[model samples]
Target chain A: MKLRRIQAIAVKEALQIVRDPRSLMIALLVPLMQMVIFGYGVNLDIRHIPLCVLDHENGQQSRNLVARFAASNYFSLRRAAGSDREVAQALDEGDCGIALVIPADFSQRLNDGGRATVQALLDGTDSNTANIAAGYAKSVVAAFSAAAQLDAVQRRGGTLQTQTPVGVEARVWFNEALESRNFIVPGIVALVMAIVGAQLTSLTIAREWERGTMELLVSTPVQPMELMIGKLLPYFAVGLADAAICLGLAVFWFEVPFHGTVATLLFTSSLFLTVVLCIGYLVSVSIRSQVGASQVALLATMLPTTLLSGFSFPIEQMPAAVQAATFLVSARYYVEILKAVFLKGAGVVELAVPILCLALYAAVVVVLAARAFRKTLD
Target chain B: MTPSAPIVEAREVSKRFGALVAVDRLSFAVPPGEIFGLVGPDGAGKTTTMRMLAGVMRPDGGQIVADGVDVLAHPEQAKRHISYMPQRFGLYEDLTVDENIRFYADLFDVPRDVRETRAAAMLAASDMLPFRKRLAGQLSGGMKQKLGLTCALVHTPKVVLLDEPTTGVDPLSRREFWQILYGLRAEGVALVISTAYLDEAERCDRLALLHGGRMVHCDTPAGLKARMPGAMLEVVSPEPRRARDALAGQPGVRGVLLIGIGLHVHVDAAGRSAGIAAALAAAGVPVSEIAEVAPSIEDLFVALLDNAETPA
Candidate 1:
């Protein structure tokens, strides 16, 4: 409760972090590394899918159809198969993700004004990539058919043409390009903050216990709450600094947009940092060992923050049990706030729920950590 | 020195760990300017008792009044009047010597002027002024203990509790550490230090011998030795073990203890030494010297344990 006492502890803890190179590396370098690696390494946008063609007819129409698939950036033509067996072999060997099989009677049927059919086969091992590739193929074939009908109409000298009754023009808001990095980089701020704030503090009190400094502190006039606050203040600053670094990298380095003001970001980040640091302090108080505290902090903060915060995966698609468990993770609410402010340009009004949740989590965790920290060795 | 009111008192304090009793109805008082030693072997509840007095642990039964404040009820207030140094000095290995001392100064909210003066004085007294900028981890074992003492004495509390402060320290450092403690006592500070060394126990103004969570004896060094039940005869023989075996459990002999190249036989009276010498000679253990001598603290401790076990 005393300011001088708290300041003393904070200064000592900061000195320790500065003196220990390993802790300094964890606080500063680890976040930067995580951002760079996760930003570029994990890509959800699929491109340059290899495609194989079986042109049995070897006609102008078949070659034109194959050129359309090649012209699109989504697909790259690997080879032209002479038979169905060869196409199958290429698909089975994983040489191509998609195959276009043009029948021999395709050009003859079209010249006779009869409909011709083509077969498109896909490798379903990686289902997400397979589905997206199939959709692109379907769109390409539809465009070709429409253009062919228009040519036929002009040749017959038709004055008018029928039009589809309905049109669906889908627009993706927030992220116009639908780039996954925009969403992921913002969420990385929360994850990095959790690691620097919680994991670093998780070792502070435990280190004191191991080194026998807690006994001296407890024997003095310092209060438990004072010790807890002092221990957390330095790491809280480190966590905020880490958050700022991540924000800069996301906006300038990774090219993710930043729609919110620095004030809002700092406000939300402070609340989230408080919650995580309290969790770390509580773990240290309970375990009271350096190695044990580090392992528990990783499991309690980093794992849950990355997995349950909807940072890397969608929480809506998670099983009901895990969905319920996400409520206990403070990172879930922080991620929501970051994504909203960064992508949606949402203000306090738009992010009332998540902001309130973060404040509540901070309050509850601070109380619990203070309560768990007793002045006695017992 | 004239007797005065106690600066620290424990009234029948007891501590239990599950079903095991670590401290049983312990009672003691430390007055101003007196060095009280809690002398015991390992697991004698010396550390536990020191922890309770320091207000870092609560005794399940009875009361601990430090500086007239009930430690269990107002631990924070009680802590302001006492400084505790644990078995390990607890110096932050990463912090510089000056930083560690300043940390304790700030925690105790010592006035800036007082802190500067006291810190310089302590450093000079402990001969640690030259290593103020050095990291604590790099300091020698002796220097570390001195630094721990300097930090603890920063606030100049009324009572100081030290738990086995010299257990790992070298003999020269142990002597220096005792010199600093003597200076503190001269300043009218009450000190309660625990140690496993019997020689160190002799340095205390008074000491309590603890065994199995109970205080077997509590008196000054000379007083405890004076309580030795009967005459102690030093027997010098070529065969010490055989001499001990021959003399032990003989007529009028209380106990026989081996004390480095000689046998100390406790007897009901000084007159019994002649009978013991005859018994040793009959058992073919030749004795060259036999004479009555004053018992040391070790002899008293062993005799106390023997008496406790036999209950005579």
Candidate 2:
């Protein structure tokens, strides 16, 4: 309740951080580096897929189809071979992510007006990118088939017309370019906030408990609420700094647009940080051992933020049970807010639910922390 | 309207952890401005009892009234009256002396101007003023304990709960630490200190002897010593442990304890020391000397515990 007491504890905690260089590095530098690493590393928007080919039908028709694959930047010709083993080897070693094979009787079939099927092999380990690559490859092959039909019709001296009355066109909004860097950078920022806010407060408070400093603090007339608030403030600032670092790198180095107002992002980010810090404090207060507290915080915050938050994996695409579990994960809502504000340029009206979720998370965690901290000397 | 009350009172306090009983139905009271000591060996429930009184732990069954407030029902308000230093006293190792002091003052909600002046006086009083700017982590063990005490006392609480505050420090620092506690007592502060050192218990106005979650005895250290059931004889022998086994619970002998390489035998006051020595000699236990001596607090503790162990 008292501001001065809270300020004093916050200042002392901040001083401890400043005194330890390793903690500072983990708090500030690690988040920025993670943003950049994840920004480049996790790409959902597949492009320029290296596609090797085994074109046994080396006739004019096959050569034209190869040219068509080259024209579409989706598939780059990495190798042209007759050996199935060599192409298979390329796919196995991941040297090429996708491969295409044309049958030996490709030109003869086309001349006879028969349908010739081309086999497309793709690496399905990374299902998202692989799925996108397979779609693009199929579309390019379909274009080649249509062009062949047109050529045949022109040679017959006939005007060609098809009756397809209606069709649907899919347009991607917000990130028209579908840049992977744009979508993942905001999630990395959320992860960084979770790590910084939770890990620091959890370790520091639990260390105090282990070393017997908490007993000293408790014996004093300092109110429990004042002590709890004071402990959270410095880490909240650190969380803010981590957020700034993530946004800076995302905007400056990766060129991801922050289309929404900075105020909204910072406000929401602060609320999320408070939630994490309170969770950390609660863990520290109840556990009493530094190692146990740190482990709890790491497991509770980091794992959920990574796996259940829809940060890298889409929660919608997950199983029904997992979708239900994500409701309890505060990071899921924050990640949605971060992505929306950064990419979709969503305002308060659109982000109110996530914001309210964060506020509620902060309130619940803080209350639990205070409750756990109320104890006796003996 | 009422007469001055005792500074602290606990009635039938007991704490249980699963099946293990830590502090049995314990009851005690400390009059105003007096030093009350909880003296017991390891696992005697000294720390647990102190923690309950400090309002850090809830008793499974009991009432702890400190400074006219129920510790269990009104912990936050009770916390305002007592300063508790756990065994470690949890000092901020990385923070400077002045910073650690200021931190506790702030935590206690001490006013700003009062904190500055009080912190200065505490440092001066403890002779820690010279190292005000030095990090607590870098200070010697004794200095850290001093700093911890200063922080605990910064808010001027009515009662101070010190849980083995001098467990690990060197002898010189232990003396200095006790001196500080003495000074606090001089200021009309009620002191409840738990210690394993019997000599330190002698300094308290009254002492509570606890063992196996039970209060073996509660009185002044001297009174506890005087109540030793028999005359204590210092026995010099070649084998102290062997002599202890031979003299222990022998007819007319109440207890046998090892003090250094010598055994102290508590015997019936009217019994003959020479006769006991002769019996030891007959038993092939070599005895160099046997002389009657006053019972120490530890001697009394060993006697009381030995008596409690035997079928009465």
Candidate 3:
């Protein structure tokens, strides 16, 4: 209950963080680097699609098709070859994103007023990019059909008419621009909290146990609950500080919108951090050695946060069993909470489920940590 | 010397960690302002007993009372009367010396003015004044141990438990550390210290010899020495290794330990030194000189362990 005691402990802990540059790098520098990499590395909207053209027929129709592909910004003509094998090799080597082949019978079919199908091959290594490439290729073919019809109408001089087609409208919610930064920065904030908060608490408590300092503290008039709360406070501050920096960068630097209240964002992130720190303390108290504590802490935080947390993958899209397992990942709900607050500007009523889940996680972890800590020094 | 009542007492206390019974039915009491020594080697449960008495751990069986307060029942209340410095006495290596002391003082809720002056006096007594501004981690091993002791006693507890505070310290630092403990004893503080060095145990007002989770003996150093059935003999010879081999398990010879080139043999104090000389001479081992010596704590410990056939 004494502020001075907590302050003393917090000051010591913060000094340790300042003294160790490697921890600072992991806590601060890495978040920024991740912000930039995840911003660009994880894009769903593919641009400057590469396509190899194989035109076996030296006719006007084939030339015109190649021109259409080159004229559009979506497809960049990488290489023009006479053999299908060459274009396939380009796709195999990842030199081109897609390949277009116009056969030798393309001019004969066009002259005979018959439909000639041109082959398009796309690489599906990156499913997102491959999907975008497929859509763009279809649109290019549609545009080519409309241009050919219009040219036919001009040649026939009002006898033939090119008629209308269907139109579609698109609207995006949450992130209208769908900038990957908006999606990734929030997740990076959660990840940073997990890594930094877990490591700080693990080292602080485990080192005390190893060095025999906890015995002194236990022998004092300090209550176990007081000690646990005091230790958890400083690390909670560190996690909150890192989250603030991440949020600031996401908003000002990356231009990601923060539609929700800052207090709500801070409070939700603090709950996630509390859960992480409690897990770290539990690991520290259970294991006597710092190395052992660190290994357990890293595995405990990283596995759940990365795989089951729905950070990179959507839980809804996963298997039913995986979706069921996501409930066990404390950070999964927190990541959702972060996105909702930062991107969607969700209010407390709208995010009640995730908030409640986080509160439950925090309570369970804190109780377990206190119990483990009570028996550690002995 | 009105025989002050026992300030700390443990009756039939026992603790077992899985298959290992670390403290077995150990009972000891430390009167006020006395230095009680718990002497044992590694894994001998010295730390376990200290932890129990310090109220950091509850004994699996039996009761521990510090100043009439049940250690297990009201541990936090009992802890207010004691300070415990474990084997690797914890120090905040990153913080300045002043900060480490202040942190402990704050934990114990020491008032501002009293804590400030007490900390200053403690640092001065331990000869750590000039180093108050230095980082604890950067201090030498001995200095760090002293700093740990200072921090432990900053709140002026009635009893202090030190778990081998000088195990790895040099002989000079060990002497200085004992001097500090003696000073604290003079201030009416009950001091319970655990150590592996039998020689250090000689300085205690009373010693508790522990071996294999059991107390072998508890008495004053001289009293334990008086219990030894034989007198320790220092035997000098040109061939000590050969002398030890020849004297091994010989009649009337209880123990033979190598001290440099000479072998210290324990024998009957009533007998003449000539008997051992003659015994070694008849066994074809050369003996230069033999003299009867007083039994040290080490000698008493060796004799007791040998008599009990327990692994020392």
Tens-digit lDDT track of model 2 for A1-378:
778877888888889888988888888887877777777787776667888989987889988888888878777888886699999899889988888899989988988999898888888887876898889988888788888888888898978863236856888888887777788878887887787678878886677777767766665556768778877877777778888888888788888887899988888888888888888888888787889998998888889999999889889899999999998988998999989998989987899989988898888888888877764554
lDDT of each: 0.88, 0.83, 0.82
**Worst ten-residue run, lDDT, model 3 chain B?**
B303-312
True contacts kept of 3: 0.79
Task: Report the C-alpha displacement of residue A15, candidate 3, in angstroms.
Answer: 2.9
In model 1, the Cα lDDT at residue B35 comes to 98
Which residue pairs show collisions in model 1? none
Residue B46 error for model 3, in Å?
2.3
**Arrange candidates by DockQ, highest first: which order?**
1, 3, 2
True contacts kept of each: 0.92, 0.85, 0.79
- Which one wins by DockQ: 2 or 3? 3
RMSD of candidate 2 to true structure, Å:
3.7
Candidate 3 C-alpha lDDT tens digits along A310-349: 7787888999998998898888988899899888899888
Relative to the true structure, candidate 1 has a C-alpha RMSD (angstroms) of: 2.4
DockQ of each: 0.83, 0.53, 0.59
lDDT of 3 at A93: 96
Q: Each model's TM-score, in the order given?
A: 0.94, 0.88, 0.88
Give stretches of model 1 more than 4 Å off. Answer: A157-166, A319-321, B1-3, B237-239, B283-287
